[model samples]
Target: MNVKLKLPFVGEFGGTWAPQRAEAEAAWELYVELATRITYVELRPGEGLVREALTSVYSLFGTTRDILRRYGPAVSPADRAGELTFGTLALTVLNLSLRPMLARWHPRLLAWEDRRPDDVSKMDHENAWDQIGELRAKLEEARLGLVQLADVLAKVAGAAPLVVDPRLLSNPEKERGGG
Candidate 1:
């Protein structure tokens, strides 16, 4: 994945770019933490408060998006061989999967939070949410996408991910009936 490039004052620099590696490592670390947190958050279901769930997920999504922004540019040149770049893939995951879910849910959840009864505990309010089941399903989808993205980031960085999702062990394209 190494690519040669010309620097402003340094002439031709070769091998893996230092900035790219740094960004990749940083992005990888963030992805791992986010993926793990999302999984844990999803596992217990209605045990946590609605605000806690919404804010945590909202924060993670924003952070992940920011890391990908930096990481994508750094490694972009290394992946310009007409192959699908990690930048493109990361963008796809964010736009196609996470964005829509978060767009619809964040505002909806906030509205729900606004209407919470004065007497209701946070947990009780969350548990009573009519869309808890739907939210849980969206969380599962988002978690899977994050895990797959984390695996790809690990591959790019040549590091061992703490959590390797089983679904990603298989060829995802083939699983989806693509070559």
Candidate 2:
């Protein structure tokens, strides 16, 4: 399938270059921050940590989606390639880190009711577990979608040309070999 990748910006002299670069840099910083928090959550895995990690992940995902939306439909092939690559990497890491935690939590939460039948009825426990399981599955699916979008973003980021002075492009080629 022929996919037309959208460039972040297209104008004489790349009119939106500065703002776009700044936004991308900011997003990168946010991603790093969230990743760090997630690492901590992985190590700790307390109630507070789980809540924080989930909140941070959702926040980061929303921010990334917003940034991608701004690029519109003008992305070039190279740019799309770069964006997709980075995005997929990020999502892959997220899935690897989150899956085990979710799996562990699901069973623990389910078992809690069995141990305390009087405190929490089997039906209530089952209902809650089912709901949580459904939510987790949905979240997993969303994570996969984000990975796909990130893959596209990575492609776009990769394909973009590095910033160079106009004079450089116009200058004659120079040989590096010694005569």
Candidate 3:
């Protein structure tokens, strides 16, 4: 998409434009990451959520909830059960009832979305370092949660997962005649 040639000022530089921003591409990459992890966790539903993953997201959302409580009235109450913070959504998505299905988290939805006319571009990045830090922590928590869900599944299982066959472990859909 870039038509401009990089006239290097004094060092190496290149003009580039892509269909998606790096963050957007990373967001799509998360789909691949989620798919892989989902397949692994499918074999072990009896295993519970990892404490760190649970606590990490809980803390992140909990803190964010506290912060967003001030702006709660700005976001639509219908989209979310409670506050609209990312942590709250994450926890809701992973509630015990939803444990059988693999859940993924989006970092962008971690904060309050204020549609109030006066709130546009109102985000004070310089004053929001703490919130940014929490977002980073949330990202790490998500990475660990996705990567470690299966490991934690394997480790925390009180008994062997009721896998039909050892071969089916890698492709459980076969056992269900879906593979």
Candidate 4:
């Protein structure tokens, strides 16, 4: 079926995942930071999606959104391909990195009076955001890179097909939607 999706994302420009390896890594970290730092486990209740988490994620989304807005249109696609790579990495981080941490933390917190995971507090000390000029620049550079990577993913997903299975929609039809 003709479909546009944010899923199975593969948006791009200037042919492929070029000129932005660092940025691409930054984009990946955005999802990682969101998954690992801001939230995880996907269920808790009122405090599960609490305000502090929302504020942190809001900052991240705003930063990334601004980056994408500035750089997205400049991408030129040499090939059209599904951006499943980004989606897959996101899923991997969610399951392998974030979920496992929560799994291990959940029971321990329960034993220790059933407190929620408060691990993120340590980041403030570790990052020491003010003193790390190099670190900050790296992050900014990564943000810029993510803009391009996200662009490729957005475009690719926009025209990509929606298929339940291989038999339902042939490979030829699926590839046709890409550049």
**Number of backbone clashes in candidate 1:** 0
lDDT (10s digit) by residue, model 3, range 39-140: 223222223323323344444334334433543433223443443322232233345313322133223323333322455433443123344344344434
Candidate 4, residues 1-179: lDDT per residue as tens digits? 11222211132222123324433444544434443443322223222322333344335545455544544533222242343334333333334333443344334333433232466443343233333343233233333333333344433434222212335655775588753
What's the TM-score of every candidate structure?
A: 0.65, 0.31, 0.22, 0.26
Q: Could you tell me the lDDT of residue 32 within candidate 4?
A: 43
Predicted candidate 1 versus true structure: per-residue lDDT over 19-80, tens digit per residue = 35655676566666665674433545755554565566567667766776665565456545
Ranking by lDDT: 1, 2, 4, 3
Question: What do the candidate models score in CA lDDT, each in turn?
Answer: 0.60, 0.40, 0.33, 0.36
lDDT of 4: 0.36
Q: Estimate, for each residue in 1-179, the C-alpha lDDT of model 2 and write its tens digit.
A: 11232221211111112124533444354344443443222222112322333455545546545544554333222555444333333334344544444555545554654554577754455445544454444444434443333333333344332223345664334443432
Off by over 4 Å in 2: 1-53, 65-128, 159-179
lDDT of 4 at 142: 33
Q: Point out where model 4 deviates above 4 Å.
A: 1-23, 46-49, 66-179
1 against 4, candidate with superior TM-score:
1
Top-TM-score candidate index: 1
lDDT of 2: 0.40
